[model samples]
Structures are given as C-alpha cells and as structure tokens.
Target: MLIFRRAKVEDFEKIKQIIKDCGLCDCDLERWLNNFMVAEEDGNVIGTGGIENYGEYGILCSVAVLPDFRNHGIGDGLVRSLINLADRMGIKTLFLFTDKAVNFFERVGFRKTNRSEIQENCPESKQLSSCPLSFIPMRLNINEFFENIKCK
Candidate 1:
C-alpha cells in the first residue's frame, strides 16, 4: 500500500538519504525536509516531491524515489499531488529545473519553457539565481492544464 502525506520532522533523515543517494538535491537537508511531501509504503518512506514558492510561481523540486521503487506510479502520483497543491494555492504556474525526467514531467502536463518565460514568472527559482543554469526549465500553465484534463 502506498501512502502520501505531508512530511513530518521525523522523516528528515530518510528524506535526506533519498536525495543524497539520488544525487539530485543540493540544498541543505533541513531545507528539503521543510519543503517536501513524502510517500510511504508499509510505513517506510519510498518517495517524495514538493514545491517551493517563488513569488507568483513555485519551484517543483526534490522529487525522488528509491531505485528499487522506480517505474511504479509513485513519482507521477507525487507530481500530481504537488500540481494540485499549486492549483489550490492560486499559483498560475509552476516550474522545475531538470537535467533528466523531462519526458516524465511532460507526460504529466508540463512543457519545456524558455528561460526568459520562466524568469518572467518565477525569477527567484534557484535555477534562475544560482544553479549552473544548464538545467532546462519546464512549466505547467494551470488554465491549460485544467482544459486538457477536461478534454481527456
């Protein structure tokens, strides 16, 4: 059984291990722990994802799943959950900087966005501020997202 829940303080070490093992997140472990939602299976955390607010938009980051647990729908489910969070918060758009998983995110309704477009909406996203700047920015426009969902 898979469970999705807001991450608690106690989940920090487990979350950090996932990030370090995945070699994705560079932020301090505490920062990620404060910003993510966790996925659990039989009480053991198996996956995680979350959004960090950046003015009018948010940054979708720290999404990772254990290697043994990949290829299941957990990551997709976590993304969908954060997308719903962005919608509920009245955020018009959400973006992420990724070197891989573009296809996965695209399949879930995000599209590759130009740097200028991303900076215009979420200039504060770390990808715009300090990251190597090589990461591709991807965005989901909420109105179009809902329209597409309805059409499906």
Candidate 2:
C-alpha cells in the first residue's frame, strides 16, 4: 500500500536518495525539518518534496518521484501534501523556481510570478537569484488553491 506522510527523522536518507535519483534539486536537511513529505510504497520511500519556510511565504523545493512511479500522480500527491502542510502552518504563500515542471505546477494552480513578488532578504528570494533566467517562478496561495480544487 502507498502512504503519504510528513517526512520523519528516519525517512531523511531515503528521501534524499529519491531526490537524487530523480535529479530535482539538492535536498536540504533544514527544509525537511520544516516542511516535507514523502510517498512511501510498501515501507519504501518512492517520492519526496518539501518547501523552505520563509514566514508568510515558502520556497517549494525538491519535488521528485521515482522513474517507475512517474505518471501515477505521486508527484502531484507530494505537492498537494506540501501545500496542505503549509496551509495548516499559517503559511499564506508558496513559490518555486523550476526550469521544468511549469506545466505540472500550472495544472496544480501555481501561477507564474516574479521574484520581486517574494519578500526581500528571505531564502526564497535568494533561490530566485540563483535560478537561471529560463527558470520560471511560480506562486500558489494554498487556501485558495484548495478551494479551487474542491470546486472542481
């Protein structure tokens, strides 16, 4: 059976491997400590994603699914779970930098946004600075996101 849960202490290593195998982004232990999720199938981690908390906003990071698990909604599930966690934590906004997965994030209701929209002096802003010009910055307001999802 597949289970989706907030990543725990024991899940960190496998989660990092999943992130590496999928070639998403470097996994930061700090992000996992703050907000992270893992998709486990039969007690094995198969997918992972998380966001770096930045007060009112967060920088979404490291969303990846195993090769064999692609097209099975595992990635989407991770994103949804991250969004849910952010919402519950009183995080009002979530943004990510992605050279790829623009379409995927868009389908999840993340709209294209500019780095200037993010708060200055925050890690999210630093990430925006490091991203290549081709990488698109996307934002999602978790509360409205779920409302839209439920309406559909």
Candidate 3:
C-alpha cells in the first residue's frame, strides 16, 4: 500500500535520491527541506513532490518517482496531496516550471501560463531563480484545482 504524508526533515535524503533518480531538476537540498511530500510503500519512498508557497500562490516543484514505481499512481497521489495542502493554505493559484512533465500536469488540470503572469508574484520569483528562461510555466486556478482533486 502507498501512503501520502507531509515530508519531514528526516525524509531529505530519500527525497533527493528520488529527484536525482528521475533526473528532472538540479534542486538544492535546502529548498526541498522547506516544502515537499513523500509517497511510501512498505516503508520505501517511491515518489516525492512539493509545493512552494508564493505568498498568494504556490509553485509545484521537485516532483519525482522511482522508475520502477511509475504508472502505479504514486505521482498522482503526491500531486493531489500538494493541491490539498495549497487549498487549505488559502493559495488561490498554483504554478510550475517543468522540463518534461507538462503533460502530467495537464492531466492533473494545469494549463500553460505565461511567464508574465508569474513574474508579478514575488514568491514565484524565488522558485524561478536559476531555472532556464525557456522552461514552460503552467498554472491552475484553485477552484478548478480542487475540482480536479475530487475527480481524481
């Protein structure tokens, strides 16, 4: 069985390994320390993801999963937990910059959002620092986000 829970400081190493394994992004350890979720099955962290609050919004980041565990729904569970956390925190919008998971986010109900819209939010700036300017930015409206969560 898979379990979803708020990531703690102790989960750091496992989370990083998952990120590195997925080869999605070169993120700092300290950043993951502040925001993330973990998916465990039989005590092994098979998947991980995070939502960095951007003041009025949140940026979904650091999503990764063990290769062998893919297609088993762990990634979707992680994303749903992050969305629920954001909604509870009162964030009305969520954003992300991804290299290859755009279709995954779209399947979860996110749409391509212009960088111009993200630039207006300061919290999003920190998440964007060091990210390639060419990365596509996607966004989800909170109301729609909750709907997607329920549907899932």
RMSD to the native, candidate 3?
Answer: 2.1
Candidates in order: C-alpha RMSD to true structure: 2.3, 2.1, 2.1
lDDT of each: 0.79, 0.80, 0.80
Q: Which residue pairs clash in candidate 3?
A: none
Candidate 2 C-alpha lDDT tens digits along 6-48: 8898887787788778766653555455478889999888988
What C-alpha lDDT does candidate 3 achieve relative to the native structure?
A: 0.80
* Candidate 3 C-alpha lDDT tens digits along 62-98: 8888999998878888888888888888889988898
How many residue-pair clashes does candidate 3 contain? 0
- What order do candidates take by lDDT, descending? 2, 3, 1
How good is model 1 by TM-score?
Answer: 0.87
Residue 17 lDDT, candidate 1, scale 0-100 = 84
Rank the models by TM-score, top first: 2, 3, 1
Residue ranges of candidate 3 with Cα displaced over 4 Å: 26-34, 148-152
* lDDT tens digits, residue span 32-126, model 1: 45557888999999988777776558788888999999999899888887777777777778888888888998888899987888777766555
